[model samples]
Target: MPKKIVKKGKKSHKNKPTSKKYTKYKIDGDKITRERNCPRCGPGIFLMKAKNRVYCGKCTYSEFESKK
Candidate 1:
């Protein structure tokens, strides 16, 4: 067996949620809104908001932010 190659470039990380689950919801003039949900995992599963990307822990799915 040989040593596995390590890919270079963007790194992957696991960041804990900064706020409580309830804080993820918002109320605006009687209208309720919630954080974006993971498309791959469907509803009831919220996506974790990072500085530049949104991630899904259950399926390791991620989306990067576009540079302005």
Candidate 2:
């Protein structure tokens, strides 16, 4: 005879995020402009842009939008 074993919690099935690095730059005429960078992290580090704010992944610095 064997005792019944129970499984605990269900595992998360979240999808992996995609890379959109190539979309970050803009080319207009002869000028090239890029997205904003993290103030705390300086030039090389870029801020992640969202619908209402932009934030830094490394430093966790966030800036929200102002209410109109």
Candidate 3:
């Protein structure tokens, strides 16, 4: 005797709910305060916040060195 094969449709997987969910960090406007130093840069280097990266105030160089 041969066993019967079952064919699944597209809706089979689509109907299943996700096991994990993603959450983002939220900042409180009233409680949160901005720091002067750049988080990306290590200590001893004084950096100022630029558009996206932090720039070293003393050397006038960006904390994120350009690749290549």
Scored by CA lDDT, what does every candidate get?
Answer: 0.82, 0.80, 0.50
Most accurate candidate by lDDT: 1
Over the stretch 35-54, how does candidate 3's per-residue lDDT look in tens digits?
A: 34444454545465566766
Residue by residue across 1-68, what tens digits does model 1's lDDT show? 99999988776777967666666688888999988888999987777888999888789789986789
| Candidate 1 least-lDDT 10 residues | 16-25
What are the TM-scores, per candidate, against the unseen true structure? Answer: 0.53, 0.53, 0.27
Model 2 lDDT-worst window of ten: 16-25
Residues 1-68, candidate 2: write the lDDT tens digits.
79788887888878855556545667888989887888999986777888999888879998886769
Query: What lDDT score is found at residue 26 in candidate 1?
Result: 80
The all-Cα superposition gives candidate 1 an RMSD in Å to the true structure of 11.3
Model 2: per-residue Cα lDDT at residue 26? 72
| TM-score of candidate 3 against the unseen true structure | 0.27
Candidate 3 versus truth, CA RMSD in Å, comes to: 14.4
**Candidate 2, superposed: residue stretches over 4 Å from native:** 1-23, 28-30, 66-68
